[model samples]
Target: MTPHISRKTRVTGAALAAAGLLAAGITVGTAGASTTQTSAKSAMPIKLSASHRAELLRDASTTKAQTAKELGLGSQEQLVVKDVIKDADGTTHTRYERTFGGLPVLGGDLVVHTAKGGAIKSTTKASKHSIKVASTTAKIAPTAAAKSAQGTATKTLSAKGADAQTPKKVVWAASGKPVLAYDTIVKGVQKDGTPSRMHVITDANTGKKLFQYDEIHTGKGESQYSGSVELGTKKDGGKFTLTDDGRGGHKTTNLENSENGEGKPFSDDDDAWGTGKPDDPQTAAVDAAYGAGVTWDYYKTVHGREGIKGDGKGASSRVHYGDSYVNAFWDDSCFCMTYGDGEGNKKPLTALDVAAHEMSHGVTAATANLEYSGESGGLNEATSDIFGTSAEFFAKSEKDPGDYLIGEKIDINGDGSPLRYMDKPSKDGQSQDNWDSNTGGLDPHYSSGVANHFFYLLSEGSGPKEIGGVKYDSPTADGSKVEGIGRDKAEKIWFKALTEYMTSTTDYKGAREATVKAATDLYKAGSPEVKGVEAAWAGVAVK
Candidate 1:
């Protein structure tokens, strides 16, 4: 008779599916019926994935293997081994051993098991414990097809049994929440899952459903930035609507197809997009929510600012804009945030720092209003960069780490280098660290160095130092000695000065004066804090 072993014990914890347990060298015998458990003729060879093997061995909380071996499997044939985990890009497949009691068996009626995270459940009675199969299906829904037809094609849907479009009228429910002319249009159930349609109310001539494209699924597919803002046109007195509905949920009644096709300005906050497409609307909503929350809180709590204009309201952050546009930007006119996906290594620029940088532009415009050229322009640009970097470090996220570099996480440059470096602005082919009349001729990115260097010196002080894993050794124009103030304190001083002292035409000297005023106000004029500010500017060679 073939020797059999029973390896069983109370293996408690989260259930884990015993995946792919195909072994080499041994075959199962015919179904053996008897009081005693079946055993391996020699030794049953079991193969397991490396990751699963490691987890089994590391699970010190249980004595499953030992208990199983003790039941029946003799030391000779009882094999308790480990495997090497391969590249775990995103999926996990593991293998585990199953025994009747605590012994190794050639073949026995054991149950298969499956669990999530950790913990085991009852095993399946299948003959095979694990089997190799094709890779898992994509976790995200399919992409939506973009509308390519040039002109707008009007197709009237049969309103039979369908909810007729509601006209613009103010309606209030018992709850006091104004149900303003809300109408729901059923597009039918989504192919992947869930129900979708249009819900909007506007004037008959307003042109709702003007532009409808396949709504991109949130989160999983490539990053798409579809942000809309209605800014005051030369004719409309700058009245613009800033709606960042990246998920394609906003539905309006009247929209015109402009020459730019999808580029037509979104008229209202609720605009319908992604012509009937299956997408993870939930994921997209969460992403947008978190992004806006982080950006808003960063500005308000950290800087004591109200909103984008310090008005206590919130700015818009659109997500899942297009198919795969891997980038984000802040439009000056629209004053909205846009995000895109990565082209190769480049990722969407939706991080906290980027949002802060963009928002700060509004702050600068309201206060210093530094021109986008010359020394003043460089100051304007660097102000955004410095504040952006500060805002990034301000946020502490395990998902995304804060660094002194801009666009580092986004990978805008396929080489993995950051978009810009404040510690050493000269690393880029064009940024300038010192003030030069000729510096104004360079692009804003390069010309931004003078102010970038100034802020660096003001915040960290000149000389060899390390703040957040980044190394720095800033120089000074005249071998003058300067002391550095910690970043936390310095940020406060600059923000205060920017909002309180500086004006639209504030220049390099004006920044110096404004900052000095801020420092003296925060710390007594002759206090150590004041001295540090002076020294920092001195180190940067700022007179």
Candidate 2:
């Protein structure tokens, strides 16, 4: 009964300014590139147009049954469309999740790629084996499975009051052969003040624990506001509430030192909010709202993503969570972002990059649904860091300019050092700069250094360079020099791979293949961009 217990990992980011300003219209250069050239290139839309998107959705929605049958899946299996992506060449990629006999099939997600004529070109599946179980009946009772899960959570996570939810029968196909299992969720609070939602999978016949993973993803950051920023507020009678109708009606609330339930909505007599000081309660709300808005804009403008779930619906932001709680997290159950005040409630973890980092977690959940364990977990964390840094750069904040350093302004370590360095991940002493056999054995936060290093080298190339007044000297695993194809291209490639190709079980090697395929799709085969991606992955010893 040795269940894999996934722990909560930390993420960090820098401050942001000009919350209302949209980066979509602005053209910014990367590293030493010319601003004019960069702006023109950035202005060109890389995502599907409105009509094309509608068409792709329609096609995907209508073809799920036929596609599933064509794929030779079991008769009891059914496909549910999750996302659709259309390329400029009229190629379409549709992502789907699988279910067997009405039971959710874990790790059964797949992507179907179709040519311009609607012919299936290829498919990427999380699990290669067929999904069929001997019987749906569970030899072990659901109550017993729940109790075992709760006990496992209590023993491994030090969870307090760990109550188990009703167990659900699911097809456990993430690893090994497909089997009927009981999926139990244990809810409680961890010893570190982090909310716990541990998912435990137990084999039905053997009553043996298969795996367990925590739902809470924790991270740290600092908030620094230089001047006033515009916030999206809605007028209700006389007072204005912290709701942004412009961007999916996203709202910000105050937890007021409480660790449970949704907090009260922030309201003001006048639209004017925040004093740019942490002493005022409204100040933290302002920072949080601003960060959420910027993150929303970053995805909407840069990635053509409507919202966190890409349904044009907004996720709420909760600030001032717990007393002196120095971390922030994203909960998919609530579909909201939660922030905490640093030690003594002095520093709020509502920086722009942190907001982006946490929200990106939601995006990953809605797309790749990456399992938060092993190498897949490392890729999950790195995806957030990559997008967090990209959003930070997109904001073009002069106060805390974009750099390769993560959480540089937060000072979470009580020292002036940043939480992690993307250029050379090993600088943190705990992170790996290159991939190895044991990379997956490290904590996801530390193992994430491999992909972070790959992204940095891909964006800025290997060797020493200066960007936004910050000096970075990135090195390759093979000590070979690699040239960059710029951050804009790198971001697009990663985004495409995540939404269209990668799956729950994808690891470093799969990530390398996904990125290369994404690059080849965006840029023609054998293009410089494709070569750059291959070289970058090799730089991280992924090859």
Candidate 3:
């Protein structure tokens, strides 16, 4: 029985499997039990020396079924691609996940690249071993398994709790032999005042605890924010349910204590909203809704992105989370944003930037599906922060001006200090300003410093400066001062890199290349955007 901490995301291996192949906008068939075979005989090579192995990717077709058959995967195996990027050079990169016997394989993610004509080119796999398990049945009773999961979660949460979310069955594939398991979500608050939404995975057969990841994505920011803003809401029947049908039916709800019971939708007789006080439940809901609306408008206006999923469908936001809890998160499982009613219920983490930050997590999930660990995970967090700041600037809110400081308003550390400094990440004493061989070992939040620094320099340049009324002094790793290309150009280049050039497996180097390509496509090769991107990466020692 071991525990694992993960970024609060609903993208479990099983989630990817169930999501199926929606990346290419093509409805494809899934591989089933009839295809099972031992990896020894399977044609998919288990190991590769190159980032993109050419041998395994040259399948007859790039379909999910074809990828499995090409690799000689078992009939029970399935592949679900989350992203597809076709380069100008006629190379197509597909990032996908694998499921065996309908169970998610944790390390079974891969990137398949093909030539212009759609012929297989190369593959980059997260794991070298084949996904094979001996059994699928559970020897332990569901009742006993439930107890086992509850006990582990209670121990992990170390706080008063209530009914655990009903345990859902999933095949645990990231570790040992594939086995039937239960993923149970336990909600509570720690004695230290931290909200906990622990996800515990218990093996059904042996009753072994396979994995546990907490969903309490910690964050808090806001000062003087929330000027007058417009929102898109929908009408259900004669009453309004805070649903935004115009932007994919986006909705906002109240969780009261944010501990128990299903959320109650926010209803209002008039379109105007929020008193800006925590005592009023709709206050936080108002902030959340306004943030969602602004973020949606930001994407549509700036990048032409329809929504977080790029499907023109909206996502939801849940406000008034756990009592006195201090965090906010985006869960793909719920396809929504969850905010804690901060310390003393005075700080609702639903500030505009916070809302946009959490929402961008969904955007990243839909786009690159960046594995939330190591360098890749750092990029994921950085992506959210980048857009968080971008959305703030886009809103041009008088109360909350856009600055490079993250969580500047929330008092997350119990002080007036900001959570992070993009210009000088080490200001907080943990994040590394430069990328090192061991940078991957740091928390995604801290490892994100490298990219954050990159974006800051790319947008504003190095040394003492002021942007939107905030002061910053940025330094470079190689002692070479870089020039700025302005924030607008930086935002467009980064967004383009994320949407069209990067993949789930992209690292800092890959990000550099992606941004360069994006700059090239948007402003030509010699444009300042391209030069700024190149110098920015060098400033962080990524080159």
Global Cα RMSD, each model: 29.5, 7.7, 13.2
What residue pairs clash in candidate 2, if any at all? 11-219
**Model 2, residue 232: what's the lDDT?**
74
Q: Model 3: residues >4 Å from true position, as ranges?
A: 1-62, 67-77, 83-94, 111-212, 223-226, 236-238, 371-373, 413-415, 496-531
Q: Largest TM-score belongs to which candidate?
A: 2
Task: Report the Cα lDDT for residue 231, model 2.
Answer: 72
| TM value for model 2 | 0.91
Model 2, residue 387: displacement in angstroms?
0.4
User: Model 2, 181: alpha-carbon shift in Å?
Assistant: 1.3
Residues 1-543 of candidate 1 have per-residue lDDT tens digits of 322211111111211110111111112132341211212111111223334445644652154456344434333322232111111121111223332223222122222122333333332111222211122222222111111111111132222222323222222111112122222233422332211232232212222222222111111112233332121111122322223232111211111211111233333222222211114232232233334444555555666454555434445555434444444444444444544433432333344455567667766654444545445566777777877767656555433445556656544456867677766678766677666667656766677777677666666666787654557677776666556555666776787666545543355666677687667655546655567777666655566
In model 3, what is the error at residue 124, expressed in angstroms? 5.4
TM-score per candidate, in order? 0.48, 0.91, 0.72
Residue ranges of candidate 2 with Cα displaced over 4 Å:
1-59
**Residue runs of model 1 more than 4 Å from their true location after superposition:** 1-288, 320-326, 344-346
Error of 3 at 47 (Å): 37
Evaluate candidate 1 by giving its C-alpha RMSD to the native, one decimal.
29.5
Instruction: Tell me the lDDT of candidate 3.
Output: 0.69
